[model samples]
Target: MSEKKFQTVQLTLEQSVESRTKLIQGAINRAAHTAGVVSLAGKGVYVIDGLLMKSGVTLDVQAGVTLMGSGNEDKYHHRPGPFELLRNQTPICALIFGNQCDNCVISGKGTISGNYRCFIKANQEQAAHIESHHYPRPEMIYLQDSRNVTVEGLTIIDSPFWTIHLAGCQQVKLANLTINNEVRMPNTDGIDLDRCQYVVVQGCKISTGDDGICLKCTEETKRFGDCTDIEVTDCQIHSQSAAFKVGSSSFGNFLSVKVVRLLIVNSNRGLAFQLRDGGLARNFQFSDVKISTRDFSEEWWGNAEPIYITFVARDHETVIKPDDGIENVQFSNINANSPTGALIYSDVAGRIKNIRFVQTQLWITTEVGKMRHYDLRPSEKRQSLIMPVSGLVGRVKQNQQAGLSVMYRSNEDQPD
Candidate 1:
């Protein structure tokens, strides 16, 4: 990395206790420059780049202080310029709560901005095809591998990749964070937690080109563990792909994921849960979600399916036993407005149970044949919907009073 020349200046806040905000913020910038790291002793404003910590560090900003990223936008605001580069290094994560460090907190109304390629790249890869040369740009922020971390009331933007990526971490609480990557530049996923547990994503607004919130398990057989006890609530999400998705990478089991009270719009697929037969995915719920799609027809992309659930089979060469299947999944109070409407499909080889849609109002804004599935029917005309497992029984009978009641036989018996 080439070293950029910086004119340094310093002021000690403990001595100059009543220093003006301008003096304090300037001193922080100088101190961070001189030390080759961001180490401002007391509460103040700071803007410097390439902050590397030799040992673990804790950045505790007081309630009213702000930790801002150095950035200025191009004249059009369509592209971001260098004034936003937080760190000159490649693996540029804001708060690296390293493995051995616990009980770390990044709080206050601090604004962290950088041209995060990881943030921009993930979103870009989804919206359009990217070339081979753009692979090495910075992509992630706030990588946590520790326990008991809390991030609240922060504005993090212009990330090159996913805003916050947590891998194999536990007891994380993320609340009241405003993360916007709505420009649709490249690969900007809002939040992705790979193989993490006890994670809570609540009260956040995420707009991107890819999945707004993605919870992933193991990518392959080499990594073995489950992602469990994740809850997301009271959030607004928009994307080019599924607003919320789980498992294009379910090599590890994903259990106990719950989502509620979400408002999602302008997505190709509103909510998609995919299981890759690598491990078991069970006990999941997607409830009270309001979804709107611009177009649902495959005329744009033949592979896009809204509200999809599938279990991808194992590749023959790997000889990995099919360890994943979805069970006990529920979708309730889902209201959708789509041009081509939604599709509910599961692969022939997958196993699913208790897929219920309670009070689902699927509005086909245009009269089209493919959306016939969302229309209601009478009670006596209902039939047993059968796929692979023959005796599998579900009777969807709609009435003017009760709306829809889909009843199935108890799991104890499957007829010969």
Candidate 2:
């Protein structure tokens, strides 16, 4: 694996859309000061108001290059002077800006158009004169605190937010991405791995409004600690939310993860392991999954569950911090057809441990109706134990024996 010798620089197309953003930022600062290979060939529309690549540069976007996004939110929120307080709360502003770079690369098969409805009408007219979190729409690739990053074969479309944001990265590699946003686009997340480490998202074809692939540790990323050894393989996810998620900004700690062979279609929720605020979603492994969830609009957070594990206490009057919950999980060979049937909650000071589901095949259908129980919540402090299956199968209604009907509730509220 040794074929590295680039010094190619070929960019020149200024037919004046304001001089094509200063001739593509001076041909990417003359191919990032000669570490070269900044080729953006033919069929031009190249108008970038932002681009800051540097370390061992290689922004080779060829195959009839499009790279357009000069949807002027004050020229992509201008503020890179004194590093602007080290990217002060990155509200929008990013059309390919990799910082703290190592062996960087943004490969091709061109098209990076994040002209998302003119930046969502310029963030709704700058949110009626500022302060709706200072609305400034712009992100079509913002890799931060980088290490050996590589974004392969791109076809990234209309993203007004989180299209590919890898923060505090380390040895990352995102392959075959074809993110197509605007399914009612709001927070357009297709790939967002924050506080990253040893990452790899393979053969991706994400469809999103939000959270098609997300793993975060926020409070604006707590100094890049634990979002350890990740791996997502052969994905084809669709989401309004949760086609694959980790938290609701879980502070940090999601070690040794693995999601294999996924195909989640028409999603509202499928495999969301959320431990709000303080996070420790331990040793997860979800294999060969195929989920098809429905039901949307409670303003979208997901109820058409194919699996939604939660360990709450984001605020039962605050103070539930250190490593909240969700442990040693495993779900093997699942094939779910949802009408809302899988949820496991834990919030009496968190404890949802050693959960396992093997050779599973669930089909809970009322043809999109009947959702009885199984949306576990703080229904009087939770604790779980639903393990007894030799290849569990369920498809309720009519002579019912596809199995799985257990209900136990006893804290003296008797019904064991």
Q: Name the top TM-score candidate.
A: 1
The per-candidate count of clashes, in order, stands at: 25, 0
The local lDDT score (0 to 100) that residue 333 gets in candidate 1 is 84
Query: What tens digits encode model 2's per-residue C-alpha lDDT throughout 1-416?
Result: 33444544344574655566556556666666665666667776576677777776788888778888787666653334222123355454687777787787889898888877764433454231111223436678887788998999989887877889887899999999899987666678898888799999999899977789989876555677878899999989998878898876666778889999999997888888766665678888999988877776544565667887776655544345555567787888878776546766555433566667767666655323332433332222432223322112222112112333322222234211
Query: How does candidate 2 fare on TM-score?
Result: 0.34
* TM-score for each candidate, following the candidate numbering: 0.65, 0.34
Against the reference, the lDDT scores of all candidates come to: 0.52, 0.70
